[model samples]
Target: MATYTINVNGKKREVDADPDTPLLWVLRDHLGLVGTKYGCGVASCGACTIHLDGSAVRSCSVPVGAIENQKITSIEGLSEKGDHPVQLAWKEHDVPQCGYCQAGQIMSASALLKKNANPTDDEIMGAMAGNICRCGTYNRINAAIKTAVKNS
Candidate 1:
Protein backbone atom coordinates (compact mmCIF):
# COMPACT_ATOMS: atom_id res chain seq x y z
CA MET A 1 0.00 0.00 0.00
CA ALA A 2 1.02 3.60 -0.63
CA THR A 3 -0.22 7.06 0.09
CA TYR A 4 -1.29 9.51 -2.59
CA THR A 5 -2.40 13.09 -2.12
CA ILE A 6 -5.14 14.28 -4.42
CA ASN A 7 -7.24 17.38 -4.66
CA VAL A 8 -10.93 16.60 -4.47
CA ASN A 9 -13.72 19.13 -4.71
CA GLY A 10 -11.12 21.84 -4.20
CA LYS A 11 -9.77 20.29 -1.03
CA LYS A 12 -6.61 18.35 -0.42
CA ARG A 13 -7.11 14.70 0.49
CA GLU A 14 -4.64 11.93 1.17
CA VAL A 15 -5.33 8.22 1.01
CA ASP A 16 -3.34 5.08 1.61
CA ALA A 17 -4.28 2.35 -0.84
CA ASP A 18 -2.84 -0.24 -3.16
CA PRO A 19 -1.25 1.16 -6.25
CA ASP A 20 -3.77 -0.52 -8.53
CA THR A 21 -6.89 0.49 -6.63
CA PRO A 22 -9.39 2.17 -8.88
CA LEU A 23 -10.15 5.81 -8.15
CA LEU A 24 -13.79 4.80 -7.65
CA TRP A 25 -12.99 2.84 -4.49
CA VAL A 26 -10.64 5.55 -3.30
CA LEU A 27 -13.31 8.18 -3.66
CA ARG A 28 -16.12 6.11 -2.19
CA ASP A 29 -14.23 4.12 0.43
CA HIS A 30 -11.13 6.08 1.30
CA LEU A 31 -12.48 9.61 1.07
CA GLY A 32 -16.09 8.88 1.96
CA LEU A 33 -17.31 10.38 -1.32
CA VAL A 34 -19.92 7.91 -2.48
CA GLY A 35 -21.71 10.09 -4.96
CA THR A 36 -19.59 8.56 -7.71
CA LYS A 37 -21.34 5.28 -8.26
CA TYR A 38 -20.12 1.85 -9.23
CA GLY A 39 -21.91 0.59 -12.26
CA CYS A 40 -19.92 -1.87 -14.35
CA GLY A 41 -16.62 -2.79 -12.75
CA VAL A 42 -15.03 -2.19 -16.11
CA ALA A 43 -15.01 1.17 -17.87
CA SER A 44 -17.79 0.18 -20.24
CA CYS A 45 -20.39 2.09 -18.23
CA GLY A 46 -20.02 5.70 -17.19
CA ALA A 47 -21.56 5.29 -13.73
CA CYS A 48 -18.20 6.03 -12.18
CA THR A 49 -17.70 9.23 -14.06
CA ILE A 50 -15.88 12.14 -12.42
CA HIS A 51 -13.83 15.15 -13.39
CA LEU A 52 -10.13 14.60 -13.27
CA ASP A 53 -8.28 17.87 -13.80
CA GLY A 54 -11.33 19.45 -15.41
CA SER A 55 -11.91 16.54 -17.80
CA ALA A 56 -14.57 13.88 -17.53
CA VAL A 57 -13.02 10.52 -16.66
CA ARG A 58 -14.11 7.03 -15.70
CA SER A 59 -12.99 6.80 -12.11
CA CYS A 60 -13.45 3.04 -12.08
CA SER A 61 -10.80 2.70 -14.74
CA VAL A 62 -8.41 5.23 -13.26
CA PRO A 63 -5.89 3.87 -10.83
CA VAL A 64 -5.45 5.79 -7.60
CA GLY A 65 -1.69 5.99 -7.80
CA ALA A 66 -1.90 7.47 -11.27
CA ILE A 67 -4.10 10.36 -10.11
CA GLU A 68 -1.82 12.05 -7.65
CA ASN A 69 -1.92 15.86 -7.80
CA GLN A 70 -4.99 15.79 -10.04
CA LYS A 71 -8.24 17.49 -9.11
CA ILE A 72 -11.16 15.11 -8.70
CA THR A 73 -14.77 16.24 -8.65
CA SER A 74 -17.47 13.78 -7.67
CA ILE A 75 -21.23 14.27 -7.88
CA GLU A 76 -21.30 15.65 -4.35
CA GLY A 77 -18.81 18.33 -5.34
CA LEU A 78 -20.41 19.17 -8.67
CA SER A 79 -21.94 22.21 -7.01
CA GLU A 80 -22.19 23.86 -3.65
CA LYS A 81 -25.87 22.97 -3.17
CA GLY A 82 -26.41 20.56 -6.04
CA ASP A 83 -27.44 23.59 -8.06
CA HIS A 84 -25.11 23.33 -10.97
CA PRO A 85 -26.85 24.15 -14.23
CA VAL A 86 -26.85 20.51 -15.27
CA GLN A 87 -28.24 19.49 -11.90
CA LEU A 88 -30.96 22.10 -12.08
CA ALA A 89 -31.79 20.96 -15.56
CA TRP A 90 -31.90 17.35 -14.42
CA LYS A 91 -34.37 18.30 -11.71
CA GLU A 92 -36.38 20.58 -13.97
CA HIS A 93 -36.70 17.78 -16.51
CA ASP A 94 -37.23 15.02 -13.94
CA VAL A 95 -34.35 13.02 -15.40
CA PRO A 96 -33.95 10.39 -12.73
CA GLN A 97 -35.92 7.18 -12.55
CA CYS A 98 -34.11 4.89 -10.13
CA GLY A 99 -31.64 7.75 -9.56
CA TYR A 100 -28.77 5.32 -9.48
CA CYS A 101 -27.34 6.66 -12.74
CA GLN A 102 -28.24 10.33 -12.34
CA ALA A 103 -25.00 11.27 -10.68
CA GLY A 104 -22.91 9.99 -13.55
CA GLN A 105 -25.36 11.44 -16.01
CA ILE A 106 -25.05 14.85 -14.41
CA MET A 107 -21.29 14.69 -14.32
CA SER A 108 -21.12 13.78 -17.99
CA ALA A 109 -23.58 16.49 -18.97
CA SER A 110 -21.69 19.07 -16.97
CA ALA A 111 -18.47 18.09 -18.69
CA LEU A 112 -20.11 18.26 -22.09
CA LEU A 113 -21.40 21.77 -21.41
CA LYS A 114 -18.08 22.87 -20.05
CA LYS A 115 -16.49 22.13 -23.40
CA ASN A 116 -19.42 23.08 -25.63
CA ALA A 117 -21.80 25.50 -24.02
CA ASN A 118 -23.93 25.59 -27.14
CA PRO A 119 -23.75 21.98 -28.17
CA THR A 120 -26.02 20.75 -30.89
CA ASP A 121 -28.33 17.79 -30.49
CA ASP A 122 -25.79 15.46 -32.02
CA GLU A 123 -23.09 16.73 -29.68
CA ILE A 124 -25.23 16.20 -26.64
CA MET A 125 -26.14 12.67 -27.65
CA GLY A 126 -22.60 11.81 -28.57
CA ALA A 127 -21.25 13.18 -25.33
CA MET A 128 -23.72 11.30 -23.15
CA ALA A 129 -23.92 8.08 -25.11
CA GLY A 130 -21.35 6.34 -22.98
CA ASN A 131 -23.27 6.75 -19.75
CA ILE A 132 -26.07 4.22 -19.78
CA CYS A 133 -29.31 4.65 -17.82
CA ARG A 134 -31.01 1.32 -17.33
CA CYS A 135 -34.33 3.02 -16.60
CA GLY A 136 -34.38 4.10 -20.27
CA THR A 137 -34.42 7.81 -19.59
CA TYR A 138 -32.51 8.74 -22.73
CA ASN A 139 -35.02 11.27 -24.00
CA ARG A 140 -35.29 12.95 -20.64
CA ILE A 141 -31.53 12.98 -20.24
CA ASN A 142 -31.15 14.59 -23.62
CA ALA A 143 -33.79 17.14 -22.79
CA ALA A 144 -32.13 17.90 -19.49
CA ILE A 145 -28.78 18.41 -21.16
CA LYS A 146 -30.34 20.81 -23.64
CA THR A 147 -32.12 22.53 -20.80
CA ALA A 148 -28.85 22.89 -18.96
CA VAL A 149 -27.37 24.43 -22.07
CA LYS A 150 -30.22 26.90 -22.26
CA ASN A 151 -30.24 27.63 -18.54
CA SER A 152 -26.52 28.22 -18.49
Candidate 2:
Protein backbone atom coordinates (compact mmCIF):
# COMPACT_ATOMS: atom_id res chain seq x y z
CA MET A 1 0.00 0.00 0.00
CA ALA A 2 1.09 3.51 -0.77
CA THR A 3 0.08 6.84 0.74
CA TYR A 4 -1.80 9.21 -1.49
CA THR A 5 -3.26 12.63 -0.79
CA ILE A 6 -6.30 14.01 -2.55
CA ASN A 7 -8.56 16.99 -2.24
CA VAL A 8 -11.99 15.84 -1.18
CA ASN A 9 -14.81 18.26 -0.68
CA GLY A 10 -12.24 21.05 -0.60
CA LYS A 11 -10.13 19.45 2.10
CA LYS A 12 -6.89 17.58 1.74
CA ARG A 13 -7.18 13.94 2.73
CA GLU A 14 -4.47 11.32 2.84
CA VAL A 15 -5.07 7.59 2.56
CA ASP A 16 -2.93 4.47 2.42
CA ALA A 17 -4.22 2.00 -0.11
CA ASP A 18 -3.31 -0.03 -3.13
CA PRO A 19 -3.00 1.83 -6.37
CA ASP A 20 -5.87 -0.10 -7.96
CA THR A 21 -8.24 0.41 -5.04
CA PRO A 22 -11.37 2.02 -6.37
CA LEU A 23 -12.24 5.51 -5.21
CA LEU A 24 -15.47 4.16 -3.78
CA TRP A 25 -13.59 1.85 -1.42
CA VAL A 26 -11.10 4.54 -0.55
CA LEU A 27 -13.88 6.94 0.32
CA ARG A 28 -15.83 4.42 2.33
CA ASP A 29 -13.08 2.33 3.86
CA HIS A 30 -10.19 4.73 4.30
CA LEU A 31 -11.90 8.10 4.52
CA GLY A 32 -15.07 6.85 6.23
CA LEU A 33 -17.15 8.85 3.77
CA VAL A 34 -20.01 6.39 3.45
CA GLY A 35 -22.41 8.74 1.78
CA THR A 36 -21.00 7.58 -1.54
CA LYS A 37 -22.61 4.17 -1.65
CA TYR A 38 -21.27 0.99 -3.26
CA GLY A 39 -23.30 -0.71 -5.92
CA CYS A 40 -22.50 -3.00 -8.82
CA GLY A 41 -18.79 -2.50 -8.10
CA VAL A 42 -18.58 -1.19 -11.65
CA ALA A 43 -19.11 2.03 -13.54
CA SER A 44 -22.52 1.04 -14.79
CA CYS A 45 -24.42 1.98 -11.65
CA GLY A 46 -24.28 5.53 -10.39
CA ALA A 47 -24.56 4.61 -6.73
CA CYS A 48 -20.88 5.37 -6.26
CA THR A 49 -20.99 8.68 -8.04
CA ILE A 50 -18.96 11.63 -6.90
CA HIS A 51 -17.70 14.88 -8.37
CA LEU A 52 -14.19 14.57 -9.70
CA ASP A 53 -12.93 17.98 -10.75
CA GLY A 54 -16.53 19.31 -10.92
CA SER A 55 -17.77 16.54 -13.17
CA ALA A 56 -19.81 13.52 -12.14
CA VAL A 57 -17.71 10.35 -12.02
CA ARG A 58 -18.26 6.73 -11.11
CA SER A 59 -16.14 6.22 -8.05
CA CYS A 60 -16.44 2.44 -8.23
CA SER A 61 -14.42 2.40 -11.41
CA VAL A 62 -11.88 5.08 -10.49
CA PRO A 63 -8.64 4.19 -8.78
CA VAL A 64 -7.61 6.29 -5.81
CA GLY A 65 -4.07 6.54 -7.12
CA ALA A 66 -5.21 7.97 -10.44
CA ILE A 67 -7.04 10.76 -8.62
CA GLU A 68 -4.21 11.95 -6.45
CA ASN A 69 -4.14 15.74 -6.32
CA GLN A 70 -7.53 15.97 -8.04
CA LYS A 71 -10.53 17.54 -6.42
CA ILE A 72 -13.21 15.15 -5.21
CA THR A 73 -16.67 15.95 -3.93
CA SER A 74 -18.84 13.36 -2.23
CA ILE A 75 -22.49 13.74 -1.39
CA GLU A 76 -21.55 14.84 2.10
CA GLY A 77 -19.66 17.80 0.68
CA LEU A 78 -22.34 18.95 -1.73
CA SER A 79 -23.45 21.44 0.92
CA GLU A 80 -22.59 22.10 4.51
CA LYS A 81 -26.22 21.72 5.59
CA GLY A 82 -27.52 19.48 2.82
CA ASP A 83 -29.37 22.48 1.44
CA HIS A 84 -28.02 22.58 -2.07
CA PRO A 85 -30.72 23.51 -4.55
CA VAL A 86 -30.72 20.04 -6.04
CA GLN A 87 -30.87 18.48 -2.58
CA LEU A 88 -33.68 20.76 -1.53
CA ALA A 89 -35.48 19.93 -4.72
CA TRP A 90 -35.04 16.23 -4.08
CA LYS A 91 -36.59 16.58 -0.69
CA GLU A 92 -39.26 18.97 -1.90
CA HIS A 93 -40.28 16.53 -4.59
CA ASP A 94 -39.99 13.60 -2.17
CA VAL A 95 -37.80 11.84 -4.75
CA PRO A 96 -36.61 8.54 -3.42
CA GLN A 97 -38.16 5.19 -2.80
CA CYS A 98 -35.42 2.99 -1.41
CA GLY A 99 -33.16 6.07 -1.41
CA TYR A 100 -30.00 4.12 -2.20
CA CYS A 101 -29.45 5.74 -5.58
CA GLN A 102 -30.48 9.28 -4.68
CA ALA A 103 -27.02 10.49 -3.77
CA GLY A 104 -25.60 9.60 -7.16
CA GLN A 105 -28.74 10.76 -8.86
CA ILE A 106 -28.49 14.07 -7.06
CA MET A 107 -24.80 14.37 -7.84
CA SER A 108 -25.45 13.80 -11.54
CA ALA A 109 -28.31 16.30 -11.53
CA SER A 110 -26.23 18.86 -9.70
CA ALA A 111 -23.43 18.42 -12.21
CA LEU A 112 -25.89 18.82 -15.05
CA LEU A 113 -27.28 22.06 -13.63
CA LYS A 114 -23.81 23.40 -13.04
CA LYS A 115 -23.22 22.98 -16.77
CA ASN A 116 -26.71 23.96 -17.98
CA ALA A 117 -28.72 26.08 -15.64
CA ASN A 118 -31.82 25.46 -17.69
CA PRO A 119 -31.53 22.04 -19.25
CA THR A 120 -34.19 20.65 -21.50
CA ASP A 121 -36.03 17.45 -20.59
CA ASP A 122 -33.99 15.54 -23.09
CA GLU A 123 -30.83 16.93 -21.63
CA ILE A 124 -31.89 16.00 -18.11
CA MET A 125 -32.81 12.48 -19.19
CA GLY A 126 -29.65 12.13 -21.18
CA ALA A 127 -27.48 13.28 -18.29
CA MET A 128 -29.24 11.03 -15.79
CA ALA A 129 -29.44 7.96 -17.97
CA GLY A 130 -26.35 6.53 -16.33
CA ASN A 131 -28.00 6.68 -12.94
CA ILE A 132 -30.48 3.91 -12.37
CA CYS A 133 -33.30 4.28 -9.87
CA ARG A 134 -34.76 0.85 -9.13
CA CYS A 135 -37.88 2.42 -7.68
CA GLY A 136 -38.53 3.77 -11.14
CA THR A 137 -38.99 7.30 -9.91
CA TYR A 138 -37.89 8.69 -13.23
CA ASN A 139 -40.88 11.03 -13.41
CA ARG A 140 -40.20 12.39 -9.96
CA ILE A 141 -36.52 12.65 -10.74
CA ASN A 142 -37.29 14.65 -13.84
CA ALA A 143 -39.68 16.86 -11.92
CA ALA A 144 -37.10 17.44 -9.21
CA ILE A 145 -34.52 18.49 -11.77
CA LYS A 146 -36.94 21.04 -13.18
CA THR A 147 -37.87 22.16 -9.71
CA ALA A 148 -34.25 22.45 -8.75
CA VAL A 149 -33.68 24.59 -11.84
CA LYS A 150 -36.66 26.79 -11.01
CA ASN A 151 -35.57 27.03 -7.43
CA SER A 152 -32.08 27.96 -8.59
Candidate 3:
Protein backbone atom coordinates (compact mmCIF):
# COMPACT_ATOMS: atom_id res chain seq x y z
CA MET A 1 0.00 0.00 0.00
CA ALA A 2 1.26 3.46 -0.80
CA THR A 3 0.86 6.41 1.49
CA TYR A 4 -0.57 9.67 0.19
CA THR A 5 -1.10 12.93 1.96
CA ILE A 6 -3.93 15.06 0.61
CA ASN A 7 -5.77 18.13 1.75
CA VAL A 8 -9.50 17.51 1.66
CA ASN A 9 -12.15 20.05 2.53
CA GLY A 10 -9.44 22.20 4.13
CA LYS A 11 -8.07 19.42 6.35
CA LYS A 12 -4.89 17.41 5.93
CA ARG A 13 -5.36 13.68 5.51
CA GLU A 14 -2.93 10.78 5.34
CA VAL A 15 -4.13 7.60 3.69
CA ASP A 16 -2.55 4.22 3.01
CA ALA A 17 -3.83 2.39 -0.01
CA ASP A 18 -2.95 1.50 -3.56
CA PRO A 19 -1.97 4.59 -5.49
CA ASP A 20 -4.44 3.70 -8.23
CA THR A 21 -7.37 3.87 -5.85
CA PRO A 22 -9.78 6.53 -7.04
CA LEU A 23 -10.06 9.66 -4.95
CA LEU A 24 -13.80 9.00 -4.70
CA TRP A 25 -13.24 5.74 -2.85
CA VAL A 26 -10.56 7.28 -0.68
CA LEU A 27 -12.87 10.09 0.30
CA ARG A 28 -15.89 7.87 0.89
CA ASP A 29 -14.14 4.83 2.33
CA HIS A 30 -11.21 6.24 4.25
CA LEU A 31 -12.18 9.80 5.11
CA GLY A 32 -15.92 9.18 5.60
CA LEU A 33 -16.85 12.15 3.42
CA VAL A 34 -19.62 10.67 1.35
CA GLY A 35 -20.93 13.81 -0.20
CA THR A 36 -19.15 13.09 -3.45
CA LYS A 37 -21.19 10.37 -5.10
CA TYR A 38 -20.25 7.59 -7.51
CA GLY A 39 -22.35 7.70 -10.64
CA CYS A 40 -20.16 6.81 -13.57
CA GLY A 41 -16.80 5.49 -12.41
CA VAL A 42 -15.48 6.29 -15.86
CA ALA A 43 -15.89 10.03 -15.35
CA SER A 44 -18.64 10.41 -17.92
CA CYS A 45 -21.41 11.28 -15.46
CA GLY A 46 -19.73 13.98 -13.38
CA ALA A 47 -21.43 12.61 -10.26
CA CYS A 48 -18.13 12.52 -8.43
CA THR A 49 -17.26 16.11 -9.10
CA ILE A 50 -15.04 17.85 -6.60
CA HIS A 51 -12.71 20.79 -6.53
CA LEU A 52 -9.13 19.74 -6.99
CA ASP A 53 -6.93 22.78 -6.48
CA GLY A 54 -9.99 24.98 -7.07
CA SER A 55 -10.99 23.28 -10.31
CA ALA A 56 -13.94 20.97 -10.71
CA VAL A 57 -12.68 17.46 -11.37
CA ARG A 58 -14.19 14.01 -11.60
CA SER A 59 -13.03 12.35 -8.41
CA CYS A 60 -13.74 8.90 -9.81
CA SER A 61 -11.03 9.41 -12.42
CA VAL A 62 -8.45 10.97 -10.11
CA PRO A 63 -5.85 8.69 -8.59
CA VAL A 64 -5.34 9.20 -4.92
CA GLY A 65 -1.59 9.55 -5.27
CA ALA A 66 -1.86 12.02 -8.12
CA ILE A 67 -3.22 14.74 -5.88
CA GLU A 68 -0.60 14.79 -3.17
CA ASN A 69 -0.75 18.14 -1.34
CA GLN A 70 -3.50 19.35 -3.66
CA LYS A 71 -6.46 21.13 -2.16
CA ILE A 72 -9.69 19.16 -2.54
CA THR A 73 -13.15 20.36 -1.69
CA SER A 74 -16.30 18.26 -1.76
CA ILE A 75 -19.93 19.24 -1.50
CA GLU A 76 -19.68 19.18 2.26
CA GLY A 77 -17.04 21.86 2.16
CA LEU A 78 -19.10 24.09 -0.08
CA SER A 79 -20.80 25.63 2.89
CA GLU A 80 -20.80 24.98 6.62
CA LYS A 81 -24.56 25.35 7.01
CA GLY A 82 -25.35 24.27 3.48
CA ASP A 83 -26.09 27.90 2.72
CA HIS A 84 -23.74 28.79 -0.07
CA PRO A 85 -25.37 31.08 -2.60
CA VAL A 86 -25.63 28.22 -5.05
CA GLN A 87 -27.16 25.99 -2.43
CA LEU A 88 -29.61 28.70 -1.52
CA ALA A 89 -30.38 29.30 -5.14
CA TRP A 90 -30.82 25.61 -5.62
CA LYS A 91 -33.44 25.70 -2.92
CA GLU A 92 -34.93 28.93 -4.12
CA HIS A 93 -35.24 27.60 -7.64
CA ASP A 94 -36.12 24.02 -6.62
CA VAL A 95 -33.58 22.56 -8.99
CA PRO A 96 -33.70 18.91 -8.04
CA GLN A 97 -35.98 16.23 -9.35
CA CYS A 98 -34.71 13.03 -7.78
CA GLY A 99 -31.75 14.84 -6.22
CA TYR A 100 -29.18 12.20 -7.11
CA CYS A 101 -27.27 14.54 -9.39
CA GLN A 102 -27.74 17.77 -7.44
CA ALA A 103 -24.49 17.51 -5.53
CA GLY A 104 -22.39 17.22 -8.63
CA GLN A 105 -24.51 19.79 -10.37
CA ILE A 106 -23.98 22.16 -7.47
CA MET A 107 -20.25 21.57 -7.50
CA SER A 108 -20.03 22.29 -11.19
CA ALA A 109 -22.18 25.39 -10.83
CA SER A 110 -20.12 26.62 -7.91
CA ALA A 111 -16.96 26.27 -9.97
CA LEU A 112 -18.57 28.21 -12.78
CA LEU A 113 -19.79 30.94 -10.46
CA LYS A 114 -16.34 31.23 -8.97
CA LYS A 115 -14.98 32.13 -12.38
CA ASN A 116 -17.95 34.03 -13.77
CA ALA A 117 -20.24 35.54 -11.19
CA ASN A 118 -22.77 36.61 -13.79
CA PRO A 119 -22.84 33.99 -16.48
CA THR A 120 -25.15 34.18 -19.46
CA ASP A 121 -27.55 31.34 -20.23
CA ASP A 122 -25.20 29.96 -22.83
CA GLU A 123 -22.30 30.28 -20.42
CA ILE A 124 -24.24 28.46 -17.71
CA MET A 125 -25.10 25.68 -20.14
CA GLY A 126 -21.49 25.52 -21.24
CA ALA A 127 -20.18 25.31 -17.71
CA MET A 128 -22.63 22.58 -16.76
CA ALA A 129 -22.44 20.70 -20.02
CA GLY A 130 -20.44 17.83 -18.62
CA ASN A 131 -22.74 17.02 -15.77
CA ILE A 132 -25.72 14.90 -16.76
CA CYS A 133 -28.84 15.00 -14.67
CA ARG A 134 -30.86 11.86 -15.17
CA CYS A 135 -33.86 13.57 -13.66
CA GLY A 136 -33.86 16.09 -16.50
CA THR A 137 -33.60 19.11 -14.28
CA TYR A 138 -31.50 21.09 -16.71
CA ASN A 139 -34.01 23.92 -16.98
CA ARG A 140 -34.29 24.27 -13.23
CA ILE A 141 -30.52 23.98 -12.82
CA ASN A 142 -29.95 26.80 -15.25
CA ALA A 143 -32.54 28.92 -13.51
CA ALA A 144 -30.98 28.26 -10.12
CA ILE A 145 -27.56 29.27 -11.38
CA LYS A 146 -28.98 32.48 -12.73
CA THR A 147 -30.74 33.07 -9.44
CA ALA A 148 -27.51 32.48 -7.57
CA VAL A 149 -25.71 34.94 -9.80
CA LYS A 150 -28.38 37.52 -9.26
CA ASN A 151 -28.48 37.01 -5.51
CA SER A 152 -24.72 37.12 -5.26
Candidate 4:
Protein backbone atom coordinates (compact mmCIF):
# COMPACT_ATOMS: atom_id res chain seq x y z
CA MET A 1 0.00 0.00 0.00
CA ALA A 2 1.16 3.53 -0.74
CA THR A 3 0.55 6.56 1.38
CA TYR A 4 -0.73 9.65 -0.34
CA THR A 5 -1.13 13.16 1.02
CA ILE A 6 -3.79 15.32 -0.57
CA ASN A 7 -5.71 18.46 0.22
CA VAL A 8 -9.43 17.74 0.09
CA ASN A 9 -12.12 20.30 0.73
CA GLY A 10 -9.47 22.65 2.13
CA LYS A 11 -8.11 20.15 4.62
CA LYS A 12 -4.97 18.04 4.44
CA ARG A 13 -5.82 14.36 4.20
CA GLU A 14 -3.63 11.28 4.18
CA VAL A 15 -4.64 7.80 3.16
CA ASP A 16 -2.89 4.47 2.81
CA ALA A 17 -3.86 2.45 -0.23
CA ASP A 18 -2.64 1.24 -3.59
CA PRO A 19 -1.30 4.19 -5.52
CA ASP A 20 -3.32 3.22 -8.56
CA THR A 21 -6.60 3.17 -6.66
CA PRO A 22 -9.08 5.47 -8.30
CA LEU A 23 -9.69 8.66 -6.36
CA LEU A 24 -13.42 8.07 -6.37
CA TRP A 25 -13.00 4.96 -4.24
CA VAL A 26 -10.61 6.64 -1.89
CA LEU A 27 -12.92 9.58 -1.46
CA ARG A 28 -15.98 7.45 -0.86
CA ASP A 29 -14.74 4.22 0.69
CA HIS A 30 -11.78 5.48 2.63
CA LEU A 31 -12.45 9.12 3.42
CA GLY A 32 -16.20 8.76 3.90
CA LEU A 33 -16.83 11.62 1.53
CA VAL A 34 -19.68 10.02 -0.37
CA GLY A 35 -20.70 13.20 -2.10
CA THR A 36 -18.80 12.15 -5.20
CA LYS A 37 -20.70 9.26 -6.71
CA TYR A 38 -19.57 6.37 -8.93
CA GLY A 39 -21.71 5.79 -11.97
CA CYS A 40 -19.10 4.33 -14.29
CA GLY A 41 -15.62 3.18 -13.35
CA VAL A 42 -14.33 4.78 -16.49
CA ALA A 43 -14.27 8.50 -17.23
CA SER A 44 -17.20 8.34 -19.62
CA CYS A 45 -19.70 9.21 -16.90
CA GLY A 46 -19.26 12.46 -15.06
CA ALA A 47 -20.96 11.21 -11.91
CA CYS A 48 -17.60 11.26 -10.19
CA THR A 49 -16.67 14.72 -11.28
CA ILE A 50 -14.82 16.93 -8.78
CA HIS A 51 -12.56 19.92 -8.79
CA LEU A 52 -8.84 19.41 -8.92
CA ASP A 53 -7.15 22.76 -8.49
CA GLY A 54 -10.38 24.50 -9.46
CA SER A 55 -10.77 22.46 -12.69
CA ALA A 56 -13.52 19.92 -13.22
CA VAL A 57 -12.17 16.34 -13.44
CA ARG A 58 -13.60 12.86 -13.51
CA SER A 59 -12.51 11.34 -10.22
CA CYS A 60 -13.32 7.79 -11.25
CA SER A 61 -10.25 7.69 -13.50
CA VAL A 62 -7.99 9.80 -11.36
CA PRO A 63 -5.42 7.84 -9.40
CA VAL A 64 -5.04 8.59 -5.71
CA GLY A 65 -1.35 9.35 -6.23
CA ALA A 66 -2.03 11.73 -9.07
CA ILE A 67 -3.63 14.35 -6.84
CA GLU A 68 -0.82 14.69 -4.34
CA ASN A 69 -0.81 18.20 -2.91
CA GLN A 70 -3.60 19.25 -5.23
CA LYS A 71 -6.68 21.06 -4.02
CA ILE A 72 -9.62 18.71 -4.32
CA THR A 73 -13.13 20.04 -3.95
CA SER A 74 -16.20 17.86 -3.85
CA ILE A 75 -19.87 18.80 -3.78
CA GLU A 76 -19.75 19.04 0.00
CA GLY A 77 -17.05 21.64 -0.29
CA LEU A 78 -18.96 23.81 -2.70
CA SER A 79 -20.44 25.84 0.12
CA GLU A 80 -20.33 26.02 3.86
CA LYS A 81 -24.09 25.72 4.30
CA GLY A 82 -24.98 24.37 0.85
CA ASP A 83 -26.02 27.89 -0.08
CA HIS A 84 -23.79 28.50 -3.05
CA PRO A 85 -25.35 30.43 -5.89
CA VAL A 86 -25.41 27.32 -8.04
CA GLN A 87 -27.07 25.30 -5.31
CA LEU A 88 -29.58 28.04 -4.65
CA ALA A 89 -30.34 28.42 -8.32
CA TRP A 90 -30.71 24.69 -8.64
CA LYS A 91 -33.24 24.76 -5.87
CA GLU A 92 -35.06 27.74 -7.28
CA HIS A 93 -35.26 26.07 -10.68
CA ASP A 94 -35.89 22.59 -9.27
CA VAL A 95 -33.12 21.12 -11.37
CA PRO A 96 -32.90 17.63 -9.89
CA GLN A 97 -35.09 14.90 -11.28
CA CYS A 98 -33.59 11.65 -10.01
CA GLY A 99 -30.79 13.60 -8.31
CA TYR A 100 -28.12 11.00 -9.01
CA CYS A 101 -26.06 13.23 -11.26
CA GLN A 102 -26.76 16.54 -9.57
CA ALA A 103 -23.51 16.56 -7.62
CA GLY A 104 -21.38 16.19 -10.70
CA GLN A 105 -23.60 18.54 -12.62
CA ILE A 106 -23.24 21.14 -9.92
CA MET A 107 -19.48 20.71 -9.85
CA SER A 108 -19.20 21.21 -13.59
CA ALA A 109 -21.58 24.15 -13.51
CA SER A 110 -19.67 25.78 -10.68
CA ALA A 111 -16.45 25.38 -12.60
CA LEU A 112 -17.95 26.91 -15.69
CA LEU A 113 -19.34 29.87 -13.77
CA LYS A 114 -15.99 30.39 -12.14
CA LYS A 115 -14.32 30.57 -15.53
CA ASN A 116 -17.03 32.48 -17.37
CA ALA A 117 -19.18 34.61 -15.15
CA ASN A 118 -21.40 35.31 -18.13
CA PRO A 119 -21.62 32.15 -20.20
CA THR A 120 -23.94 31.88 -23.14
CA ASP A 121 -26.37 29.00 -23.43
CA ASP A 122 -24.03 27.25 -25.88
CA GLU A 123 -21.12 27.64 -23.49
CA ILE A 124 -23.17 26.17 -20.64
CA MET A 125 -24.15 23.21 -22.81
CA GLY A 126 -20.59 22.66 -23.96
CA ALA A 127 -19.14 22.73 -20.46
CA MET A 128 -21.80 20.39 -19.09
CA ALA A 129 -21.79 18.01 -22.06
CA GLY A 130 -19.75 15.36 -20.25
CA ASN A 131 -22.10 15.23 -17.29
CA ILE A 132 -25.10 13.00 -17.95
CA CYS A 133 -28.34 13.33 -16.09
CA ARG A 134 -30.27 10.12 -16.54
CA CYS A 135 -33.38 11.90 -15.26
CA GLY A 136 -33.27 14.16 -18.33
CA THR A 137 -33.15 17.40 -16.39
CA TYR A 138 -31.11 19.21 -19.00
CA ASN A 139 -33.63 21.99 -19.47
CA ARG A 140 -33.84 22.73 -15.76
CA ILE A 141 -30.08 22.39 -15.41
CA ASN A 142 -29.54 25.01 -18.08
CA ALA A 143 -32.09 27.28 -16.47
CA ALA A 144 -30.48 26.79 -13.05
CA ILE A 145 -27.10 27.70 -14.47
CA LYS A 146 -28.48 30.82 -16.04
CA THR A 147 -30.13 31.76 -12.79
CA ALA A 148 -26.92 31.18 -10.90
CA VAL A 149 -25.05 33.34 -13.40
CA LYS A 150 -27.56 36.12 -13.03
CA ASN A 151 -27.33 36.01 -9.25
CA SER A 152 -23.55 35.86 -9.30
lDDT, candidate 3, 1-152, per-residue tens? 98888888888889998999999999999999998999989998889999988788999999997886789999999999999999999999888888888899999999999989888888988889999999898989998998899888
Model 2: colliding residue pairs: none
Top-scoring candidate (lDDT): 2
User: Looking at model 1, which ten-residue stretch has the lowest summed lDDT?
Assistant: 64-73
lDDT of 1 by residue, 1-152 (tens): 99888899999888999999999999999999999999998987899999998788999999998986888899999999988999998989998999998888889999989989999989988888899999999999998888888899
Candidate 1, RMSD to the unseen true structure? 0.7
Candidate 2 regions exceeding 4 Å error are none
Model 2 scores a C-alpha lDDT of 0.94
Clashes of each: 0, 0, 0, 0
Q: After superposition, how far is residue 15 of candidate 3 from its true place, in Å?
A: 1.1
Candidate 2 has what TM-score?
Answer: 0.98
Comparing 3 and 4 on TM-score, the stronger one: 4
Model 2, residue 151: distance off in Å is 1.1
Report the C-alpha displacement of residue 82, candidate 3, in angstroms: 0.5
Q: For each candidate, what TM-score against the reference?
A: 0.98, 0.98, 0.97, 0.98
Please identify model 3 stretches exceeding 4 Å from their true place. none
RMSD from true fold, candidate 2: 0.6
